[model samples]
Target chain A: MKISARNQIKGTIKSVTKGQTTSHIQLEVNGTIITASITNEAVDDLNLKPGQNAYAVIKASDVMIAVD
Target chain B: MKISARNQIKGTIKSVTKGQTTSHIQLEVNGTIITASITNEAVDDLNLKPGQNAYAVIKASDVMIAVD
Candidate 1:
Protein backbone atom coordinates (compact mmCIF):
# COMPACT_ATOMS: atom_id res chain seq x y z
CA MET A 1 0.00 0.00 0.00
CA LYS A 2 1.13 3.53 -0.73
CA ILE A 3 1.75 5.86 2.17
CA SER A 4 1.95 9.64 2.46
CA ALA A 5 5.20 9.72 4.39
CA ARG A 6 7.88 11.58 2.48
CA ASN A 7 10.91 9.77 3.81
CA GLN A 8 11.19 6.11 2.79
CA ILE A 9 14.73 4.79 2.88
CA LYS A 10 15.68 1.21 2.02
CA GLY A 11 17.61 -0.69 4.61
CA THR A 12 18.28 -4.18 5.92
CA ILE A 13 17.25 -5.42 9.31
CA LYS A 14 20.29 -5.53 11.54
CA SER A 15 18.60 -6.74 14.69
CA VAL A 16 15.25 -6.89 16.48
CA THR A 17 14.87 -6.30 20.19
CA LYS A 18 11.42 -7.11 21.47
CA GLY A 19 10.13 -5.57 24.67
CA GLN A 20 6.92 -6.05 26.60
CA THR A 21 4.68 -4.05 24.31
CA THR A 22 7.13 -2.56 21.80
CA SER A 23 10.05 -3.68 19.67
CA HIS A 24 13.15 -1.85 18.56
CA ILE A 25 14.19 -2.77 15.05
CA GLN A 26 17.69 -1.84 13.98
CA LEU A 27 17.95 -1.13 10.31
CA GLU A 28 21.38 -0.84 8.69
CA VAL A 29 21.39 1.62 5.86
CA ASN A 30 24.78 2.25 4.23
CA GLY A 31 26.74 1.65 7.40
CA THR A 32 24.31 3.69 9.49
CA ILE A 33 21.90 2.11 11.90
CA ILE A 34 18.44 3.66 11.90
CA THR A 35 16.41 2.52 14.88
CA ALA A 36 12.67 2.16 14.56
CA SER A 37 10.39 1.55 17.52
CA ILE A 38 7.27 -0.28 16.51
CA THR A 39 4.64 -2.28 18.33
CA ASN A 40 5.46 -5.90 19.08
CA GLU A 41 2.32 -6.97 17.28
CA ALA A 42 3.36 -5.10 14.15
CA VAL A 43 6.73 -6.74 14.29
CA ASP A 44 5.13 -10.15 14.51
CA ASP A 45 2.66 -9.33 11.77
CA LEU A 46 5.45 -8.20 9.49
CA ASN A 47 7.54 -11.27 10.32
CA LEU A 48 10.59 -9.02 10.30
CA LYS A 49 13.94 -10.72 10.63
CA PRO A 50 17.60 -9.90 10.35
CA GLY A 51 19.09 -9.86 6.85
CA GLN A 52 15.70 -8.92 5.37
CA ASN A 53 15.21 -5.75 3.38
CA ALA A 54 12.77 -3.14 4.56
CA TYR A 55 11.95 0.51 4.17
CA ALA A 56 11.99 3.10 6.91
CA VAL A 57 8.74 5.01 6.63
CA ILE A 58 8.61 8.35 8.38
CA LYS A 59 5.79 10.84 8.14
CA ALA A 60 6.56 14.49 7.55
CA SER A 61 4.16 15.43 10.31
CA ASP A 62 6.02 13.32 12.82
CA VAL A 63 9.22 15.28 12.31
CA MET A 64 9.93 18.09 14.79
CA ILE A 65 12.37 20.95 14.38
CA ALA A 66 14.56 22.28 17.17
CA VAL A 67 16.67 25.39 17.48
CA ASP A 68 19.86 25.73 19.44
CA MET B 1 15.39 20.82 26.98
CA LYS B 2 17.11 17.54 26.24
CA ILE B 3 15.11 15.13 24.14
CA SER B 4 15.38 11.39 23.56
CA ALA B 5 14.93 11.60 19.83
CA ARG B 6 17.99 10.34 17.96
CA ASN B 7 17.37 12.06 14.68
CA GLN B 8 17.94 15.80 15.16
CA ILE B 9 19.10 17.35 11.96
CA LYS B 10 19.94 21.06 11.83
CA GLY B 11 17.89 23.12 9.46
CA THR B 12 16.34 26.50 8.80
CA ILE B 13 12.69 27.36 9.11
CA LYS B 14 11.34 27.89 5.63
CA SER B 15 7.77 28.57 6.59
CA VAL B 16 5.20 28.15 9.31
CA THR B 17 1.56 27.43 8.53
CA LYS B 18 -0.62 27.69 11.57
CA GLY B 19 -4.02 26.08 11.75
CA GLN B 20 -6.61 25.98 14.49
CA THR B 21 -5.07 23.24 16.59
CA THR B 22 -2.02 22.12 14.63
CA SER B 23 0.72 23.81 12.68
CA HIS B 24 2.82 22.69 9.74
CA ILE B 25 6.45 23.70 10.05
CA GLN B 26 8.63 23.55 6.97
CA LEU B 27 12.30 23.20 7.71
CA GLU B 28 14.89 23.42 4.98
CA VAL B 29 17.82 21.10 5.47
CA ASN B 30 20.47 20.84 2.80
CA GLY B 31 18.07 21.96 0.12
CA THR B 32 15.41 19.52 1.29
CA ILE B 33 12.23 20.62 2.99
CA ILE B 34 11.35 18.54 6.02
CA THR B 35 7.77 19.10 7.04
CA ALA B 36 6.80 18.81 10.69
CA SER B 37 3.29 18.67 12.08
CA ILE B 38 3.23 20.16 15.53
CA THR B 39 0.69 21.75 17.80
CA ASN B 40 -0.09 25.43 17.52
CA GLU B 41 0.91 25.79 21.11
CA ALA B 42 4.42 24.60 20.27
CA VAL B 43 4.70 27.14 17.51
CA ASP B 44 3.74 29.87 19.92
CA ASP B 45 6.07 28.57 22.60
CA LEU B 46 9.00 28.27 20.25
CA ASN B 47 8.23 31.46 18.34
CA LEU B 48 9.18 29.78 15.11
CA LYS B 49 9.56 32.03 12.10
CA PRO B 50 10.97 31.96 8.61
CA GLY B 51 14.73 32.06 7.91
CA GLN B 52 15.54 31.08 11.48
CA ASN B 53 17.84 28.18 12.23
CA ALA B 54 16.26 25.11 13.75
CA TYR B 55 16.46 21.34 13.86
CA ALA B 56 14.27 18.49 12.78
CA VAL B 57 13.80 16.04 15.62
CA ILE B 58 12.29 12.64 15.08
CA LYS B 59 11.76 9.88 17.59
CA ALA B 60 12.62 6.33 16.74
CA SER B 61 9.27 5.11 17.94
CA ASP B 62 7.57 7.42 15.49
CA VAL B 63 9.41 5.73 12.65
CA MET B 64 7.84 2.78 10.86
CA ILE B 65 9.23 0.12 8.58
CA ALA B 66 7.69 -1.35 5.46
CA VAL B 67 8.64 -4.29 3.29
CA ASP B 68 8.27 -4.69 -0.46
Candidate 2:
Protein backbone atom coordinates (compact mmCIF):
# COMPACT_ATOMS: atom_id res chain seq x y z
CA MET A 1 0.00 0.00 0.00
CA LYS A 2 1.11 3.56 -0.74
CA ILE A 3 1.77 5.70 2.34
CA SER A 4 2.55 9.34 3.06
CA ALA A 5 5.34 8.77 5.63
CA ARG A 6 8.46 10.66 4.60
CA ASN A 7 11.15 8.48 6.16
CA GLN A 8 11.46 5.20 4.33
CA ILE A 9 14.76 3.63 5.25
CA LYS A 10 15.58 0.48 3.33
CA GLY A 11 17.04 -2.32 5.41
CA THR A 12 17.29 -6.02 5.99
CA ILE A 13 15.33 -7.76 8.70
CA LYS A 14 17.63 -8.96 11.45
CA SER A 15 15.14 -10.38 13.90
CA VAL A 16 11.50 -10.46 15.03
CA THR A 17 10.59 -10.65 18.70
CA LYS A 18 6.88 -11.15 19.36
CA GLY A 19 5.06 -10.22 22.53
CA GLN A 20 1.49 -10.66 23.64
CA THR A 21 -0.08 -8.15 21.26
CA THR A 22 2.90 -6.43 19.68
CA SER A 23 6.23 -7.31 18.04
CA HIS A 24 9.59 -5.66 17.65
CA ILE A 25 11.10 -5.90 14.17
CA GLN A 26 14.77 -5.11 13.97
CA LEU A 27 15.99 -3.71 10.67
CA GLU A 28 19.65 -3.27 9.79
CA VAL A 29 20.09 -0.17 7.65
CA ASN A 30 23.67 0.01 6.52
CA GLY A 31 25.50 -0.44 9.85
CA THR A 32 22.73 1.13 11.93
CA ILE A 33 19.91 -0.77 13.51
CA ILE A 34 16.34 0.63 13.66
CA THR A 35 13.75 -1.02 15.83
CA ALA A 36 10.04 -0.91 14.84
CA SER A 37 7.26 -1.86 17.23
CA ILE A 38 4.13 -3.06 15.47
CA THR A 39 1.08 -5.13 16.16
CA ASN A 40 1.39 -8.90 16.07
CA GLU A 41 -1.49 -9.00 13.61
CA ALA A 42 0.37 -6.80 11.20
CA VAL A 43 3.47 -8.96 11.58
CA ASP A 44 1.50 -12.08 10.74
CA ASP A 45 -0.19 -10.35 7.85
CA LEU A 46 3.11 -9.10 6.48
CA ASN A 47 4.74 -12.48 7.01
CA LEU A 48 8.00 -10.70 7.83
CA LYS A 49 11.04 -12.90 8.21
CA PRO A 50 14.78 -12.57 8.74
CA GLY A 51 17.15 -11.80 5.82
CA GLN A 52 14.31 -10.05 4.00
CA ASN A 53 14.43 -6.56 2.56
CA ALA A 54 12.06 -3.98 4.02
CA TYR A 55 11.56 -0.29 4.60
CA ALA A 56 10.97 1.54 7.84
CA VAL A 57 8.00 3.82 7.33
CA ILE A 58 7.72 6.81 9.64
CA LYS A 59 5.27 9.67 9.37
CA ALA A 60 6.48 13.23 9.72
CA SER A 61 3.75 14.17 12.18
CA ASP A 62 4.56 11.21 14.38
CA VAL A 63 8.05 12.69 14.80
CA MET A 64 8.01 15.23 17.58
CA ILE A 65 10.86 17.67 18.20
CA ALA A 66 11.65 18.49 21.81
CA VAL A 67 13.98 20.96 23.46
CA ASP A 68 16.09 19.61 26.30
CA MET B 1 6.07 14.91 29.39
CA LYS B 2 7.65 11.48 29.78
CA ILE B 3 6.75 9.35 26.77
CA SER B 4 7.17 5.71 25.86
CA ALA B 5 8.60 6.41 22.43
CA ARG B 6 11.79 4.48 21.76
CA ASN B 7 13.72 6.80 19.43
CA GLN B 8 14.78 10.18 20.75
CA ILE B 9 17.31 11.76 18.40
CA LYS B 10 18.94 14.93 19.58
CA GLY B 11 19.48 17.68 17.05
CA THR B 12 19.36 21.38 16.28
CA ILE B 13 16.45 23.22 14.72
CA LYS B 14 17.44 24.06 11.19
CA SER B 15 14.19 25.64 10.00
CA VAL B 16 10.49 26.02 10.57
CA THR B 17 8.09 26.31 7.66
CA LYS B 18 4.51 26.96 8.64
CA GLY B 19 1.45 26.34 6.53
CA GLN B 20 -2.22 27.02 7.21
CA THR B 21 -2.73 24.21 9.70
CA THR B 22 0.61 22.42 10.17
CA SER B 23 4.25 23.34 10.27
CA HIS B 24 7.27 21.41 9.09
CA ILE B 25 10.12 21.58 11.56
CA GLN B 26 13.50 20.59 10.18
CA LEU B 27 16.12 19.28 12.57
CA GLU B 28 19.78 18.69 11.82
CA VAL B 29 20.90 15.50 13.46
CA ASN B 30 24.54 14.59 12.80
CA GLY B 31 24.38 16.25 9.37
CA THR B 32 21.10 14.57 8.50
CA ILE B 33 17.87 16.55 8.32
CA ILE B 34 14.81 15.09 9.98
CA THR B 35 11.49 16.77 9.23
CA ALA B 36 8.64 16.87 11.73
CA SER B 37 5.10 17.84 10.77
CA ILE B 38 3.17 19.34 13.65
CA THR B 39 0.26 21.66 14.20
CA ASN B 40 0.80 25.41 14.19
CA GLU B 41 -0.59 25.60 17.70
CA ALA B 42 1.97 23.09 18.87
CA VAL B 43 4.74 25.09 17.27
CA ASP B 44 3.60 28.16 19.12
CA ASP B 45 3.09 26.20 22.33
CA LEU B 46 6.61 24.77 22.11
CA ASN B 47 7.98 28.07 20.82
CA LEU B 48 10.32 26.16 18.53
CA LYS B 49 12.66 28.32 16.58
CA PRO B 50 15.73 27.99 14.39
CA GLY B 51 19.25 27.58 15.80
CA GLN B 52 17.91 25.97 18.97
CA ASN B 53 18.80 22.58 20.39
CA ALA B 54 16.03 20.01 20.26
CA TYR B 55 15.28 16.33 19.95
CA ALA B 56 13.34 14.32 17.40
CA VAL B 57 11.05 12.05 19.38
CA ILE B 58 9.62 9.04 17.60
CA LYS B 59 7.38 6.29 18.85
CA ALA B 60 8.35 2.71 18.08
CA SER B 61 4.82 1.66 17.16
CA ASP B 62 4.54 4.52 14.71
CA VAL B 63 7.45 3.05 12.77
CA MET B 64 6.11 0.57 10.24
CA ILE B 65 8.30 -1.88 8.35
CA ALA B 66 7.23 -2.35 4.74
CA VAL B 67 8.22 -4.88 2.08
CA ASP B 68 8.21 -4.58 -1.69
Candidate 3:
Protein backbone atom coordinates (compact mmCIF):
# COMPACT_ATOMS: atom_id res chain seq x y z
CA MET A 1 0.00 0.00 0.00
CA LYS A 2 1.04 3.61 -0.52
CA ILE A 3 1.91 5.66 2.57
CA SER A 4 2.67 9.37 2.72
CA ALA A 5 5.51 9.18 5.25
CA ARG A 6 8.90 10.26 4.00
CA ASN A 7 11.16 7.86 5.95
CA GLN A 8 10.53 4.18 5.38
CA ILE A 9 13.30 2.13 6.86
CA LYS A 10 13.50 -1.54 5.96
CA GLY A 11 14.04 -3.83 8.91
CA THR A 12 13.35 -7.22 10.42
CA ILE A 13 11.03 -7.86 13.29
CA LYS A 14 12.85 -8.39 16.56
CA SER A 15 10.08 -8.60 19.09
CA VAL A 16 6.43 -7.85 19.72
CA THR A 17 5.02 -6.78 23.08
CA LYS A 18 1.26 -6.96 23.15
CA GLY A 19 -0.68 -4.89 25.62
CA GLN A 20 -4.39 -4.62 26.32
CA THR A 21 -4.86 -1.79 23.85
CA THR A 22 -1.42 -0.93 22.53
CA SER A 23 1.31 -3.15 21.21
CA HIS A 24 5.01 -2.42 21.28
CA ILE A 25 6.87 -3.59 18.19
CA GLN A 26 10.59 -3.75 17.81
CA LEU A 27 12.47 -3.77 14.51
CA GLU A 28 16.16 -4.14 13.77
CA VAL A 29 17.47 -2.04 10.94
CA ASN A 30 21.18 -2.20 10.17
CA GLY A 31 22.09 -3.21 13.72
CA THR A 32 20.00 -0.43 15.25
CA ILE A 33 16.78 -1.20 17.03
CA ILE A 34 13.61 0.85 16.53
CA THR A 35 10.50 0.64 18.59
CA ALA A 36 6.91 1.59 17.77
CA SER A 37 3.59 1.65 19.57
CA ILE A 38 0.48 0.38 17.78
CA THR A 39 -2.89 -1.08 18.53
CA ASN A 40 -3.37 -4.71 19.40
CA GLU A 41 -5.95 -5.12 16.67
CA ALA A 42 -3.46 -3.91 14.12
CA VAL A 43 -0.96 -6.46 15.40
CA ASP A 44 -3.46 -9.26 14.92
CA ASP A 45 -4.28 -8.00 11.46
CA LEU A 46 -0.66 -7.74 10.43
CA ASN A 47 0.35 -11.07 11.97
CA LEU A 48 3.79 -9.62 12.66
CA LYS A 49 6.50 -11.99 13.84
CA PRO A 50 10.18 -12.33 14.27
CA GLY A 51 12.55 -12.52 11.28
CA GLN A 52 9.92 -11.02 9.02
CA ASN A 53 10.82 -8.03 6.90
CA ALA A 54 8.84 -4.85 7.42
CA TYR A 55 9.25 -1.18 6.84
CA ALA A 56 9.23 1.47 9.53
CA VAL A 57 7.31 4.33 7.92
CA ILE A 58 8.03 7.51 9.85
CA LYS A 59 6.28 10.78 9.24
CA ALA A 60 8.25 13.92 9.91
CA SER A 61 5.65 15.03 12.43
CA ASP A 62 5.59 11.87 14.51
CA VAL A 63 9.21 12.09 15.55
CA MET A 64 10.28 14.20 18.52
CA ILE A 65 13.85 15.23 19.16
CA ALA A 66 15.53 17.26 21.87
CA VAL A 67 18.61 19.40 21.62
CA ASP A 68 20.65 21.08 24.34
CA MET B 1 24.36 15.20 19.02
CA LYS B 2 24.12 11.65 17.77
CA ILE B 3 21.05 9.68 18.65
CA SER B 4 20.44 5.96 18.62
CA ALA B 5 17.52 6.23 16.25
CA ARG B 6 17.91 5.37 12.60
CA ASN B 7 15.32 7.48 10.83
CA GLN B 8 15.90 11.25 10.93
CA ILE B 9 13.57 13.29 8.78
CA LYS B 10 14.05 17.02 8.33
CA GLY B 11 10.98 19.22 8.37
CA THR B 12 9.49 22.50 9.52
CA ILE B 13 7.24 22.93 12.52
CA LYS B 14 3.60 23.26 11.53
CA SER B 15 2.08 23.43 15.02
CA VAL B 16 2.46 22.52 18.66
CA THR B 17 -0.22 21.35 21.04
CA LYS B 18 0.65 21.34 24.71
CA GLY B 19 -1.10 19.27 27.31
CA GLN B 20 -0.57 18.48 30.97
CA THR B 21 2.34 16.13 30.47
CA THR B 22 2.58 15.35 26.79
CA SER B 23 2.76 17.65 23.81
CA HIS B 24 1.92 16.96 20.22
CA ILE B 25 4.12 18.47 17.58
CA GLN B 26 3.31 18.54 13.91
CA LEU B 27 5.92 18.86 11.21
CA GLU B 28 5.73 19.33 7.48
CA VAL B 29 8.19 17.18 5.61
CA ASN B 30 8.29 17.22 1.86
CA GLY B 31 4.65 18.29 1.80
CA THR B 32 3.62 15.56 4.19
CA ILE B 33 2.52 16.15 7.75
CA ILE B 34 4.07 14.13 10.58
CA THR B 35 2.73 14.21 14.12
CA ALA B 36 4.57 13.20 17.31
CA SER B 37 3.77 13.01 20.98
CA ILE B 38 6.40 14.45 23.28
CA THR B 39 6.77 15.60 26.83
CA ASN B 40 5.97 19.19 27.72
CA GLU B 41 9.36 19.48 29.34
CA ALA B 42 11.07 18.55 26.12
CA VAL B 43 9.05 21.18 24.34
CA ASP B 44 10.25 23.87 26.71
CA ASP B 45 13.79 22.56 26.65
CA LEU B 46 13.93 22.56 22.90
CA ASN B 47 11.99 25.79 22.66
CA LEU B 48 9.89 24.38 19.84
CA LYS B 49 7.77 26.78 17.87
CA PRO B 50 6.10 27.09 14.51
CA GLY B 51 8.34 27.75 11.50
CA GLN B 52 11.40 26.28 13.23
CA ASN B 53 13.47 23.65 11.44
CA ALA B 54 13.34 20.36 13.28
CA TYR B 55 13.88 16.73 12.60
CA ALA B 56 11.79 13.71 13.24
CA VAL B 57 14.21 11.12 14.46
CA ILE B 58 12.56 7.74 14.56
CA LYS B 59 14.11 4.62 15.93
CA ALA B 60 13.43 1.43 14.01
CA SER B 61 11.96 -0.04 17.16
CA ASP B 62 9.53 2.85 17.49
CA VAL B 63 7.82 2.55 14.11
CA MET B 64 4.89 0.17 13.77
CA ILE B 65 3.30 -0.65 10.45
CA ALA B 66 0.47 -2.87 9.37
CA VAL B 67 -0.27 -4.38 5.97
CA ASP B 68 -3.50 -5.83 4.75
Candidate 4:
Protein backbone atom coordinates (compact mmCIF):
# COMPACT_ATOMS: atom_id res chain seq x y z
CA MET A 1 0.00 0.00 0.00
CA LYS A 2 1.12 3.52 -0.72
CA ILE A 3 0.98 6.30 1.87
CA SER A 4 1.81 9.98 1.89
CA ALA A 5 3.80 10.33 5.07
CA ARG A 6 7.58 10.71 4.78
CA ASN A 7 8.76 9.27 8.11
CA GLN A 8 8.36 5.51 7.99
CA ILE A 9 10.31 3.87 10.75
CA LYS A 10 10.49 0.08 10.78
CA GLY A 11 9.99 -1.60 14.13
CA THR A 12 8.53 -4.56 15.98
CA ILE A 13 5.30 -4.58 17.90
CA LYS A 14 5.92 -4.75 21.63
CA SER A 15 2.40 -4.64 23.05
CA VAL A 16 -1.23 -3.88 22.29
CA THR A 17 -3.61 -2.36 24.79
CA LYS A 18 -7.25 -2.23 23.77
CA GLY A 19 -9.58 0.29 25.27
CA GLN A 20 -13.29 0.99 24.88
CA THR A 21 -13.02 2.86 21.59
CA THR A 22 -9.28 3.24 21.16
CA SER A 23 -6.18 1.14 21.59
CA HIS A 24 -2.61 1.91 22.53
CA ILE A 25 0.05 0.16 20.51
CA GLN A 26 3.66 -0.02 21.53
CA LEU A 27 6.56 -0.78 19.24
CA GLU A 28 10.28 -1.04 19.76
CA VAL A 29 12.31 0.93 17.24
CA ASN A 30 16.03 0.88 17.76
CA GLY A 31 15.46 0.38 21.48
CA THR A 32 13.00 3.25 21.58
CA ILE A 33 9.50 2.29 22.63
CA ILE A 34 7.03 4.24 20.58
CA THR A 35 3.38 4.18 21.54
CA ALA A 36 0.49 4.61 19.14
CA SER A 37 -3.11 5.34 19.95
CA ILE A 38 -5.47 4.00 17.36
CA THR A 39 -8.93 2.56 17.01
CA ASN A 40 -9.88 -1.05 17.71
CA GLU A 41 -10.74 -1.50 14.07
CA ALA A 42 -7.24 -0.46 13.07
CA VAL A 43 -5.83 -3.04 15.39
CA ASP A 44 -8.15 -5.68 13.94
CA ASP A 45 -7.42 -4.62 10.40
CA LEU A 46 -3.68 -4.47 10.88
CA ASN A 47 -3.78 -7.57 13.07
CA LEU A 48 -0.98 -5.98 15.07
CA LYS A 49 0.88 -8.39 17.32
CA PRO A 50 4.07 -8.61 19.29
CA GLY A 51 7.19 -9.34 17.23
CA GLN A 52 5.42 -8.33 14.05
CA ASN A 53 7.24 -5.85 11.86
CA ALA A 54 5.41 -2.61 11.20
CA TYR A 55 6.16 0.84 9.94
CA ALA A 56 5.38 4.00 11.83
CA VAL A 57 4.04 6.47 9.29
CA ILE A 58 4.14 10.01 10.57
CA LYS A 59 3.16 13.27 8.92
CA ALA A 60 5.48 16.09 9.88
CA SER A 61 2.57 18.42 10.52
CA ASP A 62 1.10 16.00 13.00
CA VAL A 63 4.18 16.29 15.15
CA MET A 64 3.92 18.97 17.78
CA ILE A 65 6.83 19.96 19.96
CA ALA A 66 5.70 20.74 23.46
CA VAL A 67 6.49 24.28 24.45
CA ASP A 68 6.90 25.53 27.97
CA MET B 1 -15.10 10.43 9.25
CA LYS B 2 -13.66 8.61 12.20
CA ILE B 3 -9.98 7.71 12.32
CA SER B 4 -8.07 5.36 14.56
CA ALA B 5 -4.89 7.19 15.41
CA ARG B 6 -4.72 9.71 18.25
CA ASN B 7 -2.94 13.09 18.58
CA GLN B 8 -5.03 15.12 16.24
CA ILE B 9 -4.16 18.77 16.06
CA LYS B 10 -6.09 21.52 14.33
CA GLY B 11 -4.28 24.06 12.20
CA THR B 12 -4.32 26.15 9.04
CA ILE B 13 -2.59 25.26 5.82
CA LYS B 14 0.45 27.44 5.40
CA SER B 15 1.82 26.11 2.13
CA VAL B 16 2.02 23.07 -0.13
CA THR B 17 5.05 22.21 -2.22
CA LYS B 18 4.57 19.42 -4.74
CA GLY B 19 7.41 17.32 -5.95
CA GLN B 20 7.63 14.47 -8.46
CA THR B 21 5.97 11.89 -6.25
CA THR B 22 5.69 13.63 -2.90
CA SER B 23 4.69 16.95 -1.45
CA HIS B 24 5.71 19.02 1.52
CA ILE B 25 2.85 20.44 3.54
CA GLN B 26 3.31 23.22 6.06
CA LEU B 27 0.80 24.09 8.71
CA GLU B 28 0.59 26.76 11.38
CA VAL B 29 -0.59 25.31 14.64
CA ASN B 30 -0.83 27.81 17.46
CA GLY B 31 1.67 30.01 15.64
CA THR B 32 4.10 27.13 15.29
CA ILE B 33 4.90 25.95 11.81
CA ILE B 34 4.47 22.22 11.53
CA THR B 35 5.57 20.52 8.34
CA ALA B 36 4.27 17.33 6.74
CA SER B 37 5.79 15.37 3.93
CA ILE B 38 2.99 13.61 2.11
CA THR B 39 2.32 12.26 -1.35
CA ASN B 40 1.36 14.48 -4.22
CA GLU B 41 -1.83 12.52 -4.57
CA ALA B 42 -2.67 13.16 -0.94
CA VAL B 43 -2.26 16.85 -1.51
CA ASP B 44 -4.53 16.75 -4.54
CA ASP B 45 -7.08 14.50 -2.90
CA LEU B 46 -7.12 16.59 0.24
CA ASN B 47 -7.10 19.81 -1.81
CA LEU B 48 -4.72 21.22 0.72
CA LYS B 49 -4.33 24.94 0.22
CA PRO B 50 -3.11 27.91 2.17
CA GLY B 51 -5.62 29.46 4.56
CA GLN B 52 -7.51 26.18 4.74
CA ASN B 53 -8.20 24.46 8.01
CA ALA B 54 -6.89 20.95 8.38
CA TYR B 55 -6.21 18.37 11.02
CA ALA B 56 -2.90 16.74 11.63
CA VAL B 57 -3.82 13.19 12.61
CA ILE B 58 -0.87 11.46 14.14
CA LYS B 59 -0.48 7.94 15.37
CA ALA B 60 1.53 7.83 18.55
CA SER B 61 3.58 4.89 17.36
CA ASP B 62 5.04 7.09 14.67
CA VAL B 63 6.20 9.69 17.11
CA MET B 64 9.86 9.34 18.07
CA ILE B 65 11.54 11.85 20.32
CA ALA B 66 15.14 12.45 19.53
CA VAL B 67 17.48 11.94 22.47
CA ASP B 68 21.09 12.74 22.89
Give the number of the best model, judged by TM-score. 2
Query: What's the TM-score of every candidate structure?
Result: 0.69, 0.75, 0.55, 0.52
lDDT of 1 by residue, A1-68 (tens): 88888777688999999999999998987666778999999999999999999988889888877777
TM-score of chain B of 1: 0.87
- The true-structure Cα RMSD of candidate 2 reads 2.8
Q: Per-residue lDDT for B1-68 in model 1, tens only?
A: 89889677677999999899999998876666778899999899989999999988889988899999
In order, the interface RMSDs are 2.6, 2.3, 5.5, 6.3
lDDT string, candidate 2, A1-68, tens digits: 67777777688999999999989998886666778999999899989999999998888988988876
Ranking by TM-score: 2, 1, 3, 4
- Candidate order by DockQ, highest to lowest? 2, 1, 3, 4
Local distance difference test scores for all models: 0.87, 0.87, 0.76, 0.78
DockQ head-to-head 2 vs 3, winner:
2
Q: Tens-digit lDDT track for model 4 on B5-64?
A: 556788999999999987888989999998987878788866778998887766756689
Clashing pairs for model 2 are: none
Query: Which is superior by TM-score, 2 or 4?
Result: 2
Model 2 earns a TM-score of 0.75
Ranking by lDDT: 2, 1, 4, 3
Interface RMSD, model 3, angstroms? 5.5
Q: Which of candidates 2 and 4 is the stronger one according to lDDT?
A: 2
Expressed between 0 and 1, the share of native interface contacts present in candidate 4 is: 0.30
- Across A1-68, the per-residue lDDT of candidate 4 in tens digits comes to 33345467889999999999788889899999988778787888767888888877666566779978
Worst 10 residues of 1 chain A by lDDT: A26-35
